[model samples]
Structure formats: C-alpha cells, structure tokens
Target: MVAASGADARKTIHPLFIRVTHWVNAFAIFVMVLSGWRIYNASPPFGFEFPAGFTLGGWLAGALAWHFAAMWLLALNGFAYLAYGLVSGHFRRSFLPISLRGALHDVLVACRGQLDHAPGRYNAAQRLLYIGVILAVIIAILSGLAIWKPVQLQALTALMGGYETARRVHFFAMAAIVAFLIVHIGLAVSVKGMLAPMFTGRAEAPR
Candidate 1:
C-alpha cells in the first residue's frame, strides 16, 4: 500500500457533476422562492403578505409561470443528483449514519473556535445539515404540488391535511430552506477560501 504523495494530499476537487448540479439547484431555488412568494401574496393564507417589491413576477399569472418553470428545473436536477448519489455511493460516503452525538460535538468545538474544514470532506454537523436541507426541499416540492393541483392530486392534498394546511406546510418548508441557505452562504463567506473552491471545484489545503 502506498501513501499519497505530498502534492496529491494537498489538493482535491469537487466532482464536475456535483458542482454543476449545485449551482443549478441554487438558481432554481432562488426563482422558486421569489415566485412562490408572489403567488402567496395573491391569496395570503396568513394575515400578512410579502412585499410586492421583494417578490418576483409582478403579477399572479406571471408568478405562476416562473414558479412552474423553476419547479420543473428543480425536480429534474434533484432526480439527477439523487441518481448520482445512489449509483456513485456519494450519499453513503458523505452523509451516512446521521450521528447526533457527533454533530453536537462538532458544534461545541466550532463554538470554541476549534473546528477545521477539509476540502471534499464534511464534518458531522455539515452532514446533518446537508441531509436536513435535502429533506426540507423535498417537503417543499411535495406540498407545492398538493397546493398546485388540489383536485387532481386530491389524495396528496388530503395526505397533507387538506389544501389550507398544505399551504402552511409549503410556506414553512420554504422558510426552512431559506434559513439553511443563509447559514450555508454565511459559512462559505466566513471561512477563508471556502467560497472559491465551491465555484472552481479545485481545493487546496493551506499549510
């Protein structure tokens, strides 16, 4: 058995498929969230509505157009990601076990400013977060479908506890996804050189 050379040990790259899917997913989410907000404003299930200025697509019809288009993009990309993860063992290698104790320990270390990151390797906390956000996105997609075609998807709507309940579920799922993005982006920007590797795919461990 041979150990990796110093040069090889110092560098790694994100897979091309992972990088491409990640960026596409980011763009799709941005479009979906803003357009969905616009659609929500039309009915306002709750007492308040999103400000028109902050939402996409000026009007309800226009918003629906954007929302549906982005939804298809998300769905297709998600399928590809899942397929790759399963076939390539990426899911098992990257986020398997879902250890709560390990994640909590990582959080504690991070609080003490002791956590260190390695390229192409996720810590316990990160693994948990990635899995959680994936679930949240899946929830948002299902609930959105329930809301979109209640009559045609009567069983799904009923499974979600009726139309109104589904809307609330959808909104909260979107909120969870948004919250994850905030932390994810904050971490990328705060950690030196983290953001660059995500875009360029190549990563180098600083000495």
Candidate 2:
C-alpha cells in the first residue's frame, strides 16, 4: 500500500455537519407530518370543530404522544443546526445573499429559466427561499408550541393573534416546509452530479 501524502490531507467543499443537520431536520419533518396527520385525523378540523370520528390512529392520546415526540426531535435538530452554524462560521456563507431587491430580481430570472448562469454559493432565489423557509420553521415551532401548551404559553398564543390564529399559522408553516421540500429535492435532482458533497464534504463544483 502506498503511504498517504500531504495532498491527501487537503480539505474540500463537501457536506459538513450543517448539511447533515439539515437532512436530519428534513427527516424529522417527515415524521412530524405523519404523526401530525394522525392527530388531525383523530380530531378533524373543519374551520373550527375538532371532530372525534376523523381520527384514523389508535386514539387521541397516542397521537399527542407521537406529535410531541416528533416535535422535540425537530426542535433539537434545528437547535443543533443553529449551534453548528454559529460555531463553524458556516452561517456567513449560507446567508450572505439576502437583499430583498436582488432576491426579487433573481426570482424573476429563475421564473424565466435564466438562473443556470447565476454564480455564487446560493443564487438570489436560493437565498430568498432558504431564508424564508428558516423563518417559516421558526414560526411553525413557536405557534405549534403555543397551541400544544396553550395554558403555559397563553401570552405567546395571544401574541400570534390568539389560540385559534396560532393554530392556523402553525398549519401554514407546515405547508410551507412541504412545498419547500418538493422544490428543493427537485432542484437537487436536476443539478448534474450534486449528491456526493453532502456525504463526502466536497462539492463537485468550485466554491
């Protein structure tokens, strides 16, 4: 076997802990969706009423357990991501392109299929979408927690326009995440040879 040389020790732009945390967050979202749906089915929400007959799971008790447990997992994953970004200096690279005017311009360009030529770690459109999704996740967690522990977080619920409004906002946040996932995965697949970086830490393209 050949001995390792200095060149073998060089670092590259591959998936780091932040990327791993992001994927874990994605998986946690999936689990949350399933458990949340089960909970919703047990008490179907139509405008306002939470009917018991809609439940498809074992019972409301089980559904609550699953939902809260999945929620904690999601929250923990998000916290870990935040800590990684802060500790590793990855946040600067990820969040640099956040100008509203520039993002809007990029959005228009993307709509016209002109983003292929854009350069940067994240093009304007990607920056807008990623930032928006992060905000959405934050809102989702806060609203959900308020609803989950209404008596404990009554002030927060009221801040979000009362309990009923908080619930609606929480649902909207979940929808945003689902929609983002569809678009994000589609982009990942459409890009040629993009999967290796996350596992190995070196992106195929120059950073």
Which 10-residue span in candidate 2 carries the lowest summed lDDT? 1-10
- Which residue pairs in model 2 clash with each other? 13-201, 13-202, 13-203, 14-201, 14-202, 15-197, 15-201, 41-54, 41-55, 42-55
> Which stretches of candidate 1 lie above 4 Å from their native place?
1-10
Model 2 bad stretches (over 4 Å): 1-11, 46-61, 117-120, 205-207
Report model 2's TM-score to 2 decimal places.
0.80
Instruction: Report lDDT (Cα) of residue 29, candidate 2.
Output: 81
Cα deviation in Å at residue 200, candidate 1? 1.8
Q: Write the per-residue lDDT of candidate 1 for residues 1-207, one digit (tens) a residue.
A: 124444465454677798889999999999999999999999888899999998999999999999998999999999899899889998998998889999999989988879988777899999999999999999999999999899999999999999999999999999999999998998889888788777777675554
* Model 1 residue pairs with clashes: none
By TM-score, the best candidate is 1
